[model samples]
Target chain A: MQITVLAGGVGGARFVRGLLSHLRTRDDAEQTSVTVVGNTGDDITLVGLRVCPDLDTLLYTLGDGVDEGQGWGRAQESTRVAGELATLGVGPDWFTLGDLDLATHLARSRWLAQGLTLSEVTARLAQRWGLPDRGVRLLPATDTPIETHVVVDDGEGGERAIHFQEWWVRHGASLPARRFTVAGLGEAKAAPHVLDALRTADVVLFPPSNPVVSIGIILGVPGVREALRGTRAPVVGVSPLLGGRPVRGHADACLAPLGVEVSAAGVAGLYADFLDGWLVDDADAGLRYPAGAQVRSMDLLMRDTEGAARLAGAALDLGRELSPVGAGTRGPR
Target chain B: MQITVLAGGVGGARFVRGLLSHLRTRDDAEQTSVTVVGNTGDDITLVGLRVCPDLDTLLYTLGDGVDEGQGWGRAQESTRVAGELATLGVGPDWFTLGDLDLATHLARSRWLAQGLTLSEVTARLAQRWGLPDRGVRLLPATDTPIETHVVVDDGEGGERAIHFQEWWVRHGASLPARRFTVAGLGEAKAAPHVLDALRTADVVLFPPSNPVVSIGIILGVPGVREALRGTRAPVVGVSPLLGGRPVRGHADACLAPLGVEVSAAGVAGLYADFLDGWLVDDADAGLRYPAGAQVRSMDLLMRDTEGAARLAGAALDLGRELSPVGAGTRGPR
Candidate 1:
């Protein structure tokens, strides 16, 4: 099947890993194409270099270079960059830039400085990593600088803007957000591959990413939501919140501030107008889906690649069921 | 009394380490001011980040953060950047940039983007290491960009310009240089402290760095050499080449192609016009000094801090002897 998955951070990476496992074992790799539209919400500029942590994490996880233990950053990473930043007394010490990871930002920064678009830069980076042929085409949400930032009300009745990573990684989404912005997304064009994949997709799956941030930020990019909404493909969303709680991420914390409920029903409602099918955890099978959208239940904990593939397969089955009988069922049908 | 030293890379850092050791223990640091004028010849703008390996080495060595095992770079380093770069297919990977050392480059690169002069940047970076106030200042030779590049004759009979680092660290100086340029030094202004230290010093010392690329590049910076020559201070230098071999570094390899002998005499000739005294190794005690310069012999190994201190003391003594008959030393006058 030709699957197009919209993804966020760690949860998204895990989901995609599972999806890849499912597709790879079905016939041969060439029979299926998985294109990922990755969120750029957690991107940050540190020491004058642009760092897209979410994009990199997805790439590394998919390319077999990710640190399995950390869930973010590269494996066998060193803290040289972080240590140096500490010596300089730069703030936000909790979120670090690894030395090896810094190389990616440096190369990306250099390429962008040379006038390459984010999409082009990402392609070059992926090529270098020998990750180009992974049956997946990774695309940034947009081909421009679009940072997701949160505005939180300071306890004394004032509000402040924080970079999304600072709110997500540093603060762990403990505080309520007044609002959030995918800054500069209004003018950003969906990266070439992103729009192309959506148009050609047989099925579009939403990995269990954050509703208020991750996947939300991608949808905020001007042409993206329209593309998904207009595609002939059946779009299936996997619930990030299972059993009334977030599976792993801070979706509850991020959603509550935006008045989003942390449940399958809440998430389904958020995407009801676009979702053709919904995949909730077995624990949340009691939830209901929109009138015409198909509903399914499965073990949602993607603890490993095997489990991820299994859930991915289940989600795909539901997607096939929801897809038009002529363009659904199997193998890019 | 104030003392000033013009320095370059490995040898220069070792000399300063020794000078600091000697001055702090045997001489009165309170009454003595030591300003080190460092070469920026080896600075390279790699991946759009300006990296000054020599200056960083000195800073880290002095700050007690140097990776003594590798002979350069930082402690607890990793190869994530290089490994990732290789994955990216970036070239010129012969010289590895350790993860920890990358932090220094990132911080420096950010500051350069902020429009700070390298001298000012160095000063600010110095403060972070909790450096002691012993009237010690590490000043750059010039405030402008002075990249030391080598013109090498390609096998095809044409010449190509290579950055000094690539030529030195990457190629291991295996190729012959048609010519070298401290590029753009003609229009560059000598940093304020460089001239001030030279003018106000009772004695000036040259550390045993590469006679051509290191100390030679410093002199090429306009106003710097003139300031040293025009000052009332006694100028003393240590021979990087002891007997017919370099005390350390690839002095012989770099100088041989230029028809410069790799011996104490060749090193003395490079500074004959300005030097008042020259320090050769005890092994080269019989070696003659260049015109108008007095010759002295000492153990210049600088194996450890104490050895460096001993060498520093020897240089100070030579400075005293070269001063007007019976004239006192700068730091221990």
Candidate 2:
């Protein structure tokens, strides 16, 4: 079976890691291949180096090199380079690049500058992390340099746009976003194999990532939404929200500008057209979901690797229940 | 009074630092200014970041942040970035960039990419080092991207060119060079203020730097040698050699391909056209020199800052002795 996953940073990375852990115990582990399409909306050029926070998070988490405490970045990371950059006043103080993490940016930036596509660079990076050996392939949603910018008040009844990172990292999303704008989204084509991954997958999984900026940004890519809607695969998603609030990150802040309710059911409504199975936290089990989607409730707090694996197992079980082999029709779109 | 110095890396930086120390003890220190024109031939782009070894050495040494033991780079430096790059197979493993040192390259590369000339970037970097407060200004020989390439045997019975750094750092300068070819040198004009610094100075000094690659490369700049020839200021130099041998660096290897003798007199001969005074070690005091230039002998080993100061003091005294006020002619070219 080929599983396609759309991922963001921390939450998405953890969920996929859990999926891998769950698969390791299954007899068909060798037969299962996973393709992850990472969100590039959070990409930014810091100090002339391209930094893809979401992609790096996925790489580190799945490679078993992620910081367990932070759930992102390299384990045993040092901030020597960041400290020096601060002394030199080169980059923003809010966003720090760890010494080990900087190597990834350097390699990515150099390769990009040399005219290699982002997909090609990601593949090279994935090799170093042994992703191929684990039957996993990581790719960017789009090769074009697309960035998510947040529109905010300019403090005098006017509006201004700031890079999403500044809004998310520097301000902690405290500034009310009027709307989110993704620069170059219209012109960006889905990266090589991205649409194919979605179209041919047996199961499509949406990890508990930010619906507004992460998965939404990926869907914004040209043809991506159509691929998801048309794919014969069973599309299952774990809600990022529980009790009208996100467990981590400012997903609520992101959804507020879009006028979407900050709840599990509201998030499922965003994917109502293609979603086959929806898994929500037990606290929101009573909430009504979209029609035609099989709703399931579970203890969704991924407290540890085991907890994450259990949640992943439940989501997979939900996906299998909705798969054509079980009961649902797998008719051509 | 204004003093201009042509410098390279370690030896040149130490000489200028010593010159500053020597001037501090003099009564006219407050009335004097110094300008340093540094060689850019050694500059290379490593892992997409511009690395100016000579300029960085000058900045770190003069700013009191240099690694005293290595005579270059930052103090208390860590090679975490380089180690990570090695693990990722991104950059050359032979050349290492310390975490602290990488920050400088990042800043410089970003500024350059933002359309700032190399001179402008150097001025900003100098501000961080407090160069203006010390009445010192540092400038690159040229703003154009010029690199020195060494033509050596390919070991397949053919000649090939490699970056100067590859020959010096990776091969330890052990490869016998057929010649040195500087890419973009002919078209590169002298950077802003470089010619003026030479033309208007009361005295010009050549520190104990490599004659073939460092100071020699600076002279190769279009108008620089002409400015020296036309300037009325007495030009004095301290020979990099002690006893027909360079105390540090591969000056001898650099000179060999040009068929120049690697001795004090031979180095003096290279600058005979503009040289007004030459300072050599006591061992080479009896060597024959060009008749127009004044010669002085000294215990030229700079064991510490004090010894370097003593040598700088002697060089300055020789310059003053050869000045028009002290019986030497100071007329138009």
Top lDDT prediction, candidate number? 2
True contacts kept of each: 0.90, 0.88
Q: What tens-digit string does per-residue lDDT give for candidate 2 at A1-333?
A: 788999999999999889999989998898888999999999999998999999999999999999989888999999998887787788898999998999999999989989999999999999999999988999999999999999999999999999999999999999999999999999999999999999988889999999999999999999999999989888999999988899999999999999988899989999999999999999999998889799999899988878888888888888888786741334453
Q: Candidate 2 residues B1-333, lDDT tens each?
A: 789999999999999999999999999899889999999999999999999999999999999999999999999999988987888888888789999999899999989999999999999899888888988999999999999999999999999999999999999899999999999999999999999999988889999999988999999999999999989899999999989999999999998899998899999999998999999999999999888899999899988889889998898899888887641334543
In candidate 2, residue A307 scores what lDDT?
Answer: 82
Mark the 10 consecutive residues where model 2 chain B has the least summed lDDT. Answer: B324-333
* lDDT score of residue A242 within candidate 1: 84
lDDT of 2 at B140: 98
Per-candidate TM-scores read 0.92, 0.97
Question: What value of lDDT does candidate 2 attain over all alpha carbons?
Answer: 0.92
Clashing pairs in 2: none
